[model samples]
Target chain A: MKEIYLDNNATTKVDEAVFEEMRPYFCELYGNPSSMHFFGGQVQGKVSEARNRVAALLGASPEEIIFTACGTESDNAAIRSALEVFPERRHVITSRVEHPAVLTQCRNLTQKGYRVTEIGVDGAGRLDMEEYRKAIDDDTAIVSFMWANNETGVIFPVEEAAAIAKTKGALFHSDAVQAIGKIPINMDGSAIDMLSLSGHKLHAPKGIGVLYLRRGTPFRPFLVGGHQERSRRAGTENAAAIIALGKACELAGQHMEAENTIVKAQRDRLQDALMVAIPNARINGGGAERLPNTTSIAFEFVEGEAILLLLSELGICASSGSACTSGSLEPSHVLRAMGVPFTCAHGSIRFSLSRFTTDTEIDTVIREMPAIIARLRQMSPFGREFLKGQA
Target chain B: MWDYTPIVKDHFLNPRNVGDIPDADAVGEVGSLACGDALKLYLKLDDNKDKILDAKFQTFGCASAIASSSALTEMVKGKTMDEALAISNQDIADFLGGLPEEKMHCSVMGQEALEVAIFKYRGMDIPEHDSEHDHGHAYPDHEGTIVCKCFGITDTFLKKVIETNRLTTAEQVTHFTKAGGACGGCIPKIQELIAQVLGDADVQPRTRPEKLSNMKKMQLIQEVLERDVRPLLWADGGDLELIDIDGSRVQVAFRKACAGCASSGNTARMVEVKLRDLVAEDIVVEEVSA
Candidate 1:
């Protein structure tokens, strides 16, 4: 069976170019970037070049970029460093639809004594700017929000939010893990103080991320150890993955146009086919501005896990925001925060496309999905009633 | 992904009886859309009305849930109503080569559906028993004292699972019964139940406190804060001053460094729960603006 990989928002397959660029770092250039020896010093030069490439992709300076393990670490480093820099600030502001990295961390902060104000989102998954504006006060140390939601693919007004946070004298951060490769971002003109990006979300191998900290921002290191990342992040560098990330960022910069055009067209084709073929199927965040390469469709009355399992049997890989898929008793927090009806929320499936996704793969999914949903709906009690009503 | 057994995967992929039985002798439904899984069981009885001629199920859930329902319908087929009613959740799980610990509720739902089906067949009200059948005694139903607010697991239900599973630890209880799986506010109660079931003679039975008036509750909260909480806060260069008490809501202000401390919410919750434990078991403490 030919595999059709569509779950790119979860993680993408490493680009061949990135893999090739990283190969030498693993074998021939296997020198610690921190060592003072000639071989190691030569490797350190490549690491710096990699940082410059990554910085160039984000329109940030090399000095502003700090490489971490992954997006979660970058998010943690940004939020924790901000709080540490301002010990007197008692409050933090964030959106209710943040990834677990930010949401769970913010919730954990409340237990430690920090006041947290979670701004709500509208039915289409757009943030309530008025509530967000009110939430940021003198006590707030940082305002952390996502650039694009992973599940819904809803793009937030991060630049505007950051500008608002600036007036309140709070550090602003955006977890742009999902938005980095799919959309254009220029940090040179944006008010966002810190931004996070994961390598794997683009085409790089996992375990590599970049935290873009605006130069001259009040600084505190989350990890205090080695003289690495200019002492901003402490640890021996993941040289090979870092090199891979640099190549991936360069590829992302080149492919950004294709991502918004060709890949987005394929996503729309699949979305249109699924919506037309399946009954009561609606896009989760269709009303809001979303990433071009992603679509979250909710097939009401039929469960997502069952649909996903059936899709898996056909060699098609996708993801769901359903409770069962997440191993949680509740559906995705993003869906819940947007007030998605329980009928639809439990059946939401997220199909994210990458540069590798082909038109044939999208066609295969469109051809097979309706039959899968029909089979499951026939067995579903609520779905049977819905079908009967339709009849 | 869950390590689902091949049998479970097979059953879910190809459910045995997937449809509602029209003109069925009895029908039973359990769970709701909000709960994320639900099952409706239909039984077609023989002329004698005691033997189940056929069984069908319609389920809305994950793989384990669907497999459990499918396995249930297959298990109950051709069995008498009494025998069908005797089949436990363990039997459903065993048939499917065992379900994941967290997905045990799916099997439990199957058993509940069977019990309800039997009740419907006999035209009897479904007994408010702990669903898990082992001791064979139907304990008095007390839905008021809900221990695990996350799953709505009552005190009686907690004791029943503890007694049936012979569970000694709170972790095991959470595994078999998802009582403290969410929010975990009821974990202490679950631990107390485990101790009680394990025959720890030192542990006394918890008695329900009588509802206090607003004035009396406020007075107790202030007294407790001054006597117990204030000393701990003062020791940490922090002070807790009670501002107002509106019913169960106890509003207090943190002074000094404690106000800006990251762990203040935990401190506030600790104070709230402590006052609730001492005063009324429903006290909510909030950090009020000074």
Candidate 2:
């Protein structure tokens, strides 16, 4: 069976070019960048070159980028550094719909006597600017928000939000893990103090991430170890992954147009076809300015896990924000924060496309999804309730 | 992923008796939409009205839930009402190889549905069975003291499962009963119950703190917030005010820059922990919208 992979927001297939670029670093170019030997010096130059390439993609200076384990670490380093640098500032701000990396970290800070303000989102998952404006004050050490929500693919106005935070004297951070390669980001004049990007989200192998810290930002290291990442982040570099990520960033820069156009068209085609074929289906965060290659559709009455399991039978991979899919009793926090009705929230499925997603794959999903939803709806009690109401 | 058994996966994929039986002799429903899993069981009885001729179920839940419901129907088919009622949640789990510990509630729902169906068939009042195990504490007005607020598992239910399963540790109880699987606020309570059940005569029953007037509690919380917490937040351009005092729950609203801070939960927990240390041990601080 041909697998139609659409869960790119969860993670993506490592691009072949990136894999090939990283192959030499694993064994042949295995010398540690930290070593003083000639072999190590040769490898060190490549790491710097990789950093420059990544910096180029983000329109940032090479000195501003610090590579880390993954997006979570980048977020952790950004928030922790800001809080530590300004110990007197006890307030942190973030959106209610951030990935757990930022959300959990902010929540954890409150335990340490820091006040955390979680700005709410509109029904369509757009952040309320007024709420955010009021949330920031001189006491806030950092304002961390996501560039694009993982579940809904809703793009936040991070540049504006970061500017607001900056005016309040708060260090602003954006977890752009989902947005980095898919969208254009020019940090040359942006007020964003820190931004996080993960390698795996953009077709690089996992375990590689970049934390973009604007030059001269008050900094404290999250990991204090042997001098690395200019002591901003400390560890022997993940040479192969760093190299892979650099190559991936270059590829992403090359493919950004295709991502917004062809891949986006595939996503829309699948989403529009599913919506037309399946009755009572609606898109989550459809009202918001969203990422081009993503759609989250809620098929009312039928549960998401059932839809996913049936889809799995057909080798079609997707994801859900439903409570059942997550072990927790509540649905996705993003959906709940947006006040998505429980009926629809339980049935939300997220389909995130990548450059690799083909029209045939989109067609396969569009063809098979309605039958899957129809089958699950037939079995669901809620589905029967809807039917009764219709009758 | 839940590491669901092959049997469970098979049952979830091709759930048996997946719809309602129209004109069924009895129907029973358990759980609710808010709880994240619910099952409605329909039994079509034979002419004698004792044998379950057909059993169908409609479920809204995860894979384990659907599998449990499907397993219940398969297990109860052709069984007398008495036999069907006797089948415990463990039977459903056993039939499906085994369910994950956290998902035991799904199987429990299956057993409750069967009992309710039997009661419906006999035209008898459904017995209240909140906990997974019922150790003859079948009171008409069953309102056991809620121990685990996360799952709403009661003390009586917790005691019943602990004793029946001969569970030695709180972890085992959590596995079988799910009383402490979430939030973990009840693990200490669960531990105390375990000690009490293990016949530890020296284990003293926890004393309820002397109840204070609402105004007095609010005043005390306010004083603590101002003296201990306010200065720390103020340094950072944030502050908190006591909102409401309801029983042990001290509702607080963040002020100044902290009002919309994302880590308010952690801050609230800090307040709760601090207040518990300084003022009262049972105080639970919660953040409310301003």
Identify the candidate with maximal lDDT: 1
Residue A91 of model 2 has an lDDT of: 93
Q: What is the TM-score of chain B in candidate 1?
A: 0.59
Q: Once superposed on the true structure, which residue ranges of model 2 sit more than 4 Å away at CA?
A: B127-290
Model 1 TM-score relative to the real fold: 0.83
Question: How much does candidate 2 score in TM-score?
Answer: 0.81
Residues A1-391 of candidate 1 have per-residue lDDT tens digits of: 8789999999999999999999998879999999989999988988998999999899999999999999999999999999999999989999999999999999999999999999999999999999998778999999999999999899999999999999989999999999998899999988999999999999999999999999889889999988898899999999999999998999999999999999989999999989999989999999999999999999988788988998999999999988787767678889889998877788999999999999889989999999988888888777888899999
TM-score versus the correct structure, for each prediction: 0.83, 0.81
Q: Tens digit of lDDT per residue, candidate 2, span A258-337?
A: 99999888888888899899899899999998999889998877677777888888999999998667766567889989
TM-score of chain A of each: 0.99, 0.98
Give one digit per residue, the lDDT tens place, for model 2 in B98-124: 676667767877886787777766777
lDDT of 1 at A81: 92
